[model samples]
Target: MPQRLIASVLLGHYLSAFTTLGIPLYLPRILADLAPDAPGWSIGVLFILPTLCTALAAPLWGHLADRHGCRLSLLRAHAGLCAGFLLAGFSPNLTVFVLALMIQGTFGGAMAASNAYLATQLKDGNLSRALNWTQYSARLAMISGPILLGLLTASGMGLELYRVLAWLPLLAFVLILPLPADAPRRQARTSDGDGDEWPDQLPNDLPRLLAVQFLFSFAMVVTFPYFVPYGEALGVGNDALIGLLYSLPHLVYLVALPWAQRQAANLLLPGLGLLALTNALQFWSDQPDLLFTLRLLSGAGMLLGFVGLHRCLSQRSRNGSAGRLFGWYDSSGKWAGAAAGVTAGLVSQSCGIASPFLVAGLVAFAALVLARPLLIAPREITA
Candidate 1:
C-alpha cells in the first residue's frame, strides 16, 4: 500500500477508536450530567443499547458496500458518527442520550468498511500486515484517548470535553474524502483443475470463527465496563491511573504484535490459556501494581489469539464479499458484547464487581476449546 493510503486509514482508525473508546473513559461523568439519580447499572444499559444497534446495522452496511461501493459506505458511516456525537453532546437527558447512541450505532460501519476497502487493496501477506497495522492504530488510540480525557477531567474541563471531541470525526470525514474510490470486486471464481470454489458464500470455518469472536467479545466486555470502578474500589482513584489501567493491555498489545504475528500458530492455545489465567487471577489481586501486570499479560494473549484469528479470516476472503464477511464478523462480536454488558451488570448487581472477571475467564476457557480445531500453522506471508 502507498504511504498516503496507509496514513489515511490510520487517521480514520484513530478518530473512530478515540471517539468510541474515549466516551467510556468519562462515562460516569456523562451519566451524572444527564441523569443525576440514575442507578449504576444504567452505565451497562447505555453501552448495551448502542452496541445492539451496531450489531443489527453491520451486515446491512456490508451488503450495501458490496452492492454499491466502499467509498460511499465510508462517507455515510463517518457522517453518521459525527452527527451521533454532536447529538450526544447536546442531549439534555438520559433518554435523548440513548437515542443519540442508537443513531451512532446505526451509522457506524466505518471499521468494517475500512477493513473491506483495505482487503481489496492488499492481498495475501501484505493484507495481514496491513490489518495488523490498522489494529495497531486502533490500539494506539485506545491508549492516548483515555489519557487525554483523564487530563482534561482532572483539569476541570471534562464537562465540555465530549462536545469538543465531537468535532474530531468531522475532521476525519474530510480526511477520507480525498482517498481513491473503491468499487466492488464481483468476479466469478475460476476452476484451476482442483474443482469449483464459490465466491458468494463465506468459508466453511466461518461459523466456528464467528463463535470464537462471540466468546472473545463476551470475555472482554464482561470486565471492561467495570474496570474503572473496580480500580476505585481497590484504592486507585486518580483519573490518570484509572485511564492507565484501562489502556494497559492495549499498550502491551502494541509491543507484542510483531511476535504474535510471527508466532501465530504456535501461540494460539497458550495465548488463550494465559488470558484465562490472567482473568482468573484478577480475583486474587486488589493491588494496583498486580492488576496492571495482569492486564499487561492479558494484552499479550489478545495479540496472539485475535491477531491469529483475524489473519486466518482475511486469508479466507473470496469473491467480492469481503465487506459482507467482515461485517458479519464485526456484528457477531458487537452482539456478544451487548449481551455481555447486560449480563455483567446483572452479575455485578447481585454479586460483586470482581465476580465478572472470573466469569469472563471461564468464558475464555470455552473459547480456547472451540479454537483448537481451527488452529492451523499459518503460512509465512512475504511482502
Candidate 2:
C-alpha cells in the first residue's frame, strides 16, 4: 500500500472526527437556542436520531459502493458530510436543522467508507495495520478535538459553531480527491444467469460474528456517556484528570498499536474477560486511586476487543464485498452504541451512576459466554 493512501485516510478521518464528536458536545446549547420549547424526551431523541439513521442506512450505501467503486463511495460520504454541515449551519429553523442532521446520518458514513476503501487496497496484516491507524486518528482526535474547540471558544469564535465545522469536512473532501480509486470487482453472473452484479461472499455463520460485534460494542460504549459522572461520584475532583481517565482506553490504544497489530482479533476473548472483571470491581472501589486503576484496566480490555474485531472482519472480507461486509459490521456497532447510551442513561437514573458499569460488565460476561465458537473458530471463507 502506498504511504500516501494511508496518510490520506488518516488525515480525512481525523478532520471528520471533530464533526463526529463535536456536534454532540455542543448539542445542548444548539438545542436550547433553536428549540427552547422542546420537551426533554425530544432532546434525547434528537441527540440519537443521527446514529439511528446511520444504523439503518449503512448497508444501502455499502451496497452502492460494492456496485460502483469505493473511491466514489468514499467521496460520496465526504460530500454528504460537507452538505450536512452546510445545511445545519445555514438552517433557518429547527425543522431544517433536524432534517439536515438526518441527512448527515443517512449519508455521512466516512469511517465505514474509509475502512472499506482500505480493505479494497490491503490484505491480512497490512489490512489490520491500516485499520489500527484509522482508529489511532480517531483516538487522537478525541483527546485533541475538544481542546481545540475549547481554545476557539475562548478566542470568541464559538458563535455559529456549525458554520465553522462545515469547513473541516469540505477540506477533507478535497484531500481525498487525489487518492487512488478502487474499481469494483464484479462477477459476470450468478448460477441463475443474472447480469453483471456484484455477488456477496457470505459464509453461513455471519450472524454469529455480527452478534459478537453487537455485544462487544454495547459493552464498551454503554459506559461512555456516564463515565465522567461515575468518576465524579467516586471522588475524583479534577476535571482534567477525569477527562484523561475517560480517555485512558484511547490513549492505551495509541501506545499499544505495534503490539495490537501483531495480536489482532486474538485479543477479543481475553479482552472481554478483563473488561468484565474490572467493571464489576469498580462498583466496590470507593477510593479514587482504585477507580483510576480500574479505568486503566478497562482501557486494555477495550483495546483488545477493538483490534480483535477489525482483524476478523479484514480476514473475512472477500473481493468486491468489503464495502458491504464492513458496512453491516459497522451497523451492528452503530446500533449497539445508540442502545448502550440509552441503556446507560436509564440505568444511571433508576439505579446509580455506577450501575451502568455493572450492567456493561454483565453484558461483556454474557458475550464471552456465547461468543466462543463464533469468534475463535477458523475463518469461514467464501469461494
Candidate 3:
C-alpha cells in the first residue's frame, strides 16, 4: 500500500472515531443547553438513535461501496459527518440536533469504507497489520478526543466547542479527495444471469465470528458506563483519577497492538480467558490499585481478542465481499454494545454495579468455549 493511502485511511478513521467518541464527554452540557428540563429517558434516546441508525446504515453503505467505489462512499460519509456536526452545533432545538445526528448516521460508514478500501489495497498478511494500525489510531482518538473537548469546554468554549470540532471531518473530506480513486470489484454473475448484488448467504463461520464479536463487545461495555461510579465507590472521587482509571485500559491497548498483531492467530482463547479472569476478579476488589491492574490486564486481553478476530475475518472474507462483511461485523459489535449498555444499566440498578462484571465474565467465558473450533481451525474462505 502507498504510504499516502495508509495515512489518509488512518487519518480518516481517527477523525471519524474522534468526533463520535467525543460526543459523550460533552453530552450532558449539550443536553443541558438544548433541553434544560430534558427527561432521563431522552438521554438514552439521544445516544441510541445515532447508534441504531448507524448500525442499520452500515451494510447498505458497504454494499454501495461494493457497487460504486470506496472513495466515493467515504467522501459521502465525511460530507454527512460535516453537515451533521454543523447542524448539531448550531441547532436551536433538541429535535433538530437529533435529526442531524440521524442524518449523520445515515451517511456514517467511514470506518467500514476505510476497511474495505484497505482490503483492496493490501494483501492478507499486510492487511492484518494495516487493520491493527487503523484500530490503534481509532483507539488513540477515543482516549484523547474527549480530553481535548473537555479541556476546550473548561476553557470557556462550551457548546461552541461543537462548532469548532465540526471542521475536522470537513478536513478529512479534503484529505481523502487527493487519494487515488477506488473502483468497485466486478462480481461474478449468478446461474440465472442476475445482476450484481451482495452475497445472499454468508460463510458458515461468519455467524460464529459475529457471536464472538458480540460477546467481546458485551463484556467490555457491561462495565464501561459504571467505571466512574465504580471508582467513586472505591473512594477515588477525583474526576482526573477516575478518568485515568477508565483510560488505563486503552493506553495499554495501544501499547499492546503490535504484539497482538504478531500473535494474532493464537490469541483468541488466551485473550478471552484473561478478559474473563479480569472481569470476574473485579467482583472481588474495590481497591483502586487492584482495579487499575485488573483494567490494564483486561485492556491487554481485549486488544488480543479484538485484533485476532479482525485478522481472522479479514483473512476469511472473499475478495469482493470485504466491505459487506466488515459492515456486518461493525454492526454486530455496535448492536451488542447497545444491548450490553441497557442490560448492564438494569443489572446495576437491581443487583449492584459489581454484578454486571460477573455477568460479563460469564458471557466472555461462554464465547471462548463456543468459538474454540473456529479459532483453532485452519483458515479458509467460505461461501
For each candidate, what is the lDDT? 0.76, 0.80, 0.78
The digit string of per-residue lDDT tens for model 2 on 166-262 reads: 7888888898898877767564123214533324565445687788889888988888898888889988889999988888887888898778677
Q: Which tens-of-lDDT digit does each residue in 1-383 have in candidate 1?
A: 36787678768867877888776757887788778899997776776676788899999998887667666787788788888888888887778888888998899766776777777566656667777777787788777787788778777764366577777778778888888876554533332122244544566777787898899778877898788888888888797788777777788778877867775354666777888889999866877778878988888877777676667767777545677878888899888988887788788888898888898899889989998876673322211
Candidate 2 residue spans exceeding 4 A from truth: 157-159, 185-199, 381-383
Measured with C-alpha atoms, the lDDT of residue 378 in candidate 1 is 37
Alpha-carbon deviation at 173 in model 1, angstroms: 2.1
User: Judged by lDDT relative to the true structure, which candidate is superior, 2 or 3?
Assistant: 2
Regions more than 4 Å wrong, model 3: 187-202, 378-383
Which has the greatest lDDT?
2
Q: What is the lDDT of residue 39 in candidate 1?
A: 96
- Candidate 2 structure lDDT: 0.80
Instruction: List, residue by residue over 1-383, the lDDT tens digit for candidate 3.
Output: 38878888899878877887887667777788789999977887777777788888888887777677677888888888888888888888888888888987777767777777787667677777788787788789989898788778787665566677778888888888888875564642232135333332245678788888889888988888887787888888799888888888789889977767776255878889999999999877877778778889989888877777767776665546667777888888778878988998899999887888898899999888977877566654445
Q: Name the 10 consecutive residues with the lowest summed lDDT in model 1.
A: 187-196
The whole-model C-alpha lDDT of candidate 3 against the native structure comes to 0.78
Please tell me which model should have the higher lDDT, number 1 or number 2: 2
Point out the worst 10-residue segment of candidate 3 by lDDT.
188-197
RMSD (Cα, Å) of candidate 1?
4.2
Root-mean-square deviation of every model: 4.2, 3.1, 3.2
Rank by TM-score, highest first. Answer: 3, 2, 1
